[model samples]
Target: MLLVVEDDQAFAGILKNLSHEMGFQVLLAGTAEEALSLARDLTPSAIILDVGLPDQSGLSVLDRLKRNVHTRHIPIHVVSAGDHAQTALSLGAVGYMLKPVRREQVAEVLAKLEARLEQRMHRVLIVEDDERQRDAVSKLLASDDTETVTAGTAAECLELLRTQTFDCMVLDLSLPDTSGYALLETLSQQDAYSFPPVIVYTGRELSADDELRLRRYSKSIIIKGAKSPERLLDEVTLFLHQVVAELPEQQQNMIRQARNRDALLEGRRILVVEDDVRNVYALTNILEPRGALVEIARNGKEALERLATSQLHRELAVDLVLMDVMMPVMDGLTATRAIRENPAWAKLPIIALTAKAMPDDQQRCIEAGASDYMAKPLDVEKLLSLVRVWMPK
Candidate 1:
């Protein structure tokens, strides 16, 4: 659900509709008090907060939400007509969407939140001797999305490790079983990649050496006390958010590669040899936008002519050639051999397009000195992959 905290009815209506179009249930809040009340009630997945609330300053509202255990996990975006983006961020807003926000800007902000929500937050394992303290830790950390498991001592924690995996760990320094120091040493021995991040949420005060020793095993040590719950949540949330924000770009690259888009495939010269005009147009449609300068030939005979001319003229040098298997004037096999015979164009790559079911077609093209062969009707991605391989970087 999306919560829009705005005083302007007209603009609020616009945002509500836009969010609905993007598949979010919209809730409207006109004042800071109303926004806070709605936030506590709905616990929105994301918030679009207007800084110009009637009752109180929006930053104050943001502060209140951040301090609350139930609402801080919900990401907030500051919307403003003025330059308060930096200030809002300092106060704990995840992002700032400037106003008057257009449909495109709203769409972009939604996309960011969508990406963030798609990632799973950390699964934490809490290790403590005191049952009350352990249950309290669980209560503070667990939400609709986060998972928590408790281990009372080092032996129990080690036993759990044999069967479970955690994203982060909350530890108690003083335990009846093995000490936290021993547990840290044991956990530190796991291969770096598989080791879960450890957070030392112990009450005991430490010397310089103990602190240094804990540093090798855990992410941080938070001494348990009055303000610790909020501080602990803040630290844990930072780790979880970091995982979402630093997610490998290749993971997000699935959409781009979905249509076999060659986004970075640019600035190359290619010649397409095909008798059919439709095939030429299809090839152009895909290649031109990728910044390729595509030239055309009616048949394999004209392909040879173009290759000969390109070899003689340096500026016209074709980076690669896509040769059609059959043509009215001359076949692609003969043109490929001709291209290979010339010492100047010998190193040039010529890929043959052939029927998908013909087993001997590829071997025939290879024998004729073609660089590679792809079956038609061209798979756009396979074609682009072949182009990338042959084109000069």
Candidate 2:
């Protein structure tokens, strides 16, 4: 099934006709809202998105789809009038096409989607220094349709990658011959080797710097622990686009439990400090459904007062804060530093939100004591993912 999101009636008709010629059942969405609803309800095999939508940008729609566990594995191709190809691809769209597209271009995109849907086998590379650990992961992820390849060092991993392409790679940061960090850097510098979506599954305790570095090279990072195996299965299956229902009952249960942990926001209190009522409303809509108690603060000064009062009245304790950077009375950066200075709020997670997504802006937010940073206009799914990752576990 192919879901087409386009407000332009003529263009949508053209897309529908082309898709039918390829023997794909077509579902059309005239607005972003409709697209999101159909996607969440039907879980289409692939999506063809347009940038111009009545309610929201197509890029945000793409962001939300990729963040959602059920919809993340589905391939998406963007057809836009704007030059947002880079952004769309970064958000996980498989391919991007500009407006005034040729028939061959659309056909090519559909062909690629067909190939992905028809491919029966998925190859995975497990790169771990310990032979026992490598073998164990291979066994755990083993399936009738999956081919698992193992490497005990960075050199061997690189050698395998140079010759053959893989669907995904499960990497460990600790390698005997070279560190995982070095290997990733090597891959980034060289263009000959195939670099697949890497899941960094390791036992190494990582510092903030280490994590930030790894985020550049890896798709998901799982620290070895009691529930690590289940989480690994969940991530691997997602990247492989495997059919969960077809898997063994035991693996299915593991995937279910791993996904259930995403409900970390349930019953948690989040303080949303923003001057804009529109943003406040949007955040509320996203968080409240997840069972999070949403509290609003007009500005940075109001946020500080609320925190102070919450501390004085233990019953009002907030689990996390979504601080908007640009605000009257007091900016979020100032508020974040003040909160960090307070001994009582030392462990509280503060995520800084800003309209500017520039590198320097991110650096400033980090320097001001923000636990993390996100750019506006907010991507609903990414915001939820960040909240889950930063919220107290």
Candidate 3:
């Protein structure tokens, strides 16, 4: 399905009709809120966004979507009166279209999209010690036409590289023969496949310096223990260089369920306690697509109030909380303690988010009753992985 987010009804209709004629299932949203809601619920293949909106800038919406692990992977285009192609591209938009929309330009752009979707030429190298994790990630990534090569250690990976070429590499940092970092540095020196887009999948908690160093050779980083096998697939998809997202809704859902740990979070309620509006928006963008009903509070006090009122007045139960470590009035650690103190919510899953990666800080969150703790500037894929583990399948 392709979603066209536009405020102008007539223009929206024009785009919808045009999309359908071009062999696409179409969905339309008139406001940013509707756009966001539908983007999550429908999990559209691509989004044609309008810059001007009744509620918010399409650029803002794009920023939020790109931060989401699920929706971030979908292709998006900007359709607007003014040219925002440069800004949009910098922000992750695939392409842009000017207003006074024409069938020719739409056709040309979508033809390119269709060609991308129908792609089949791709191969990935999986470097990990755990066979179970390796297979799980490989399943999500291996379409019928794609080939996956697995290596149990950095040494094995190096040996494979000398003999065969690959489109991508999924690396686990800790290896028996050598460090994944050393392996990446080694690859950078080799003349093999032009530094194929690399993704780091590891259990090690990296410091800022470590992350900076890895960024030299890798496209992304996802911590392993955070239910991260699916994330490895996500990173692998980035290198696949193909597109086929224009399938029917049922087919799309089926494929999504298959790729997404073999299950989608269809009915779930989640609370995010964070003072940053942007973070809340990003989190909502990610969770909504996974079928979670999301609610937000700026700080711990409001979170408590919302939790209490929902349980007592609405007779509703919140399934999980994504709590921010630093906040006004009440911080995540304190909030975690308060929630645990209430017997009814004692065992509720609470995941802490912090800018700090200090061991002491993580321990504090755990001691205060948080189920897990993640470093912020979130690794989006890692965040979702953790959420999936804590929530019921």
- Over 60-179, each residue of candidate 2 has an lDDT whose tens digit, in order, gives 678677656678788889998877664465455677898999989999999999999998999999999888888989998989899999999999999999999998889888789988
Q: Which ten residues in a row have the lowest lDDT in candidate 2?
A: 218-227
Q: What is the C-alpha lDDT of each candidate?
A: 0.73, 0.83, 0.73
What does each candidate score in C-alpha RMSD?
Answer: 22.5, 9.1, 14.0
- The TM-score-based order of candidates, best leading, equals 2, 3, 1
Highest-TM-score candidate: 2
TM-score of 3: 0.42
| Residue-level error in angstroms, candidate 3, position 317 | 28
Q: For model 3, what is the C-alpha lDDT against the true structure? A: 0.73
Per-residue lDDT for 1-393 in model 1, tens only?
989999999999988988898889989999977898899887889898987676545766776675455676678888888765544653456678777777898888888877767767558888899999999889877765578999998888887877777767777787898888887787677643334656677665456477667656434433333225555655565445432223335422322232232322444689999988888999999899876889999888898888889868877878899999888888889888888888888778788987564778877998999877777898774577567545532
Which candidate, 1 or 2, would have the higher TM-score against the true structure?
Answer: 2
Candidate 3 clashes between residue pairs 3 or more apart in a chain or in different chains:
116-243, 117-243, 117-244, 118-243
- Highest lDDT, which number? 2
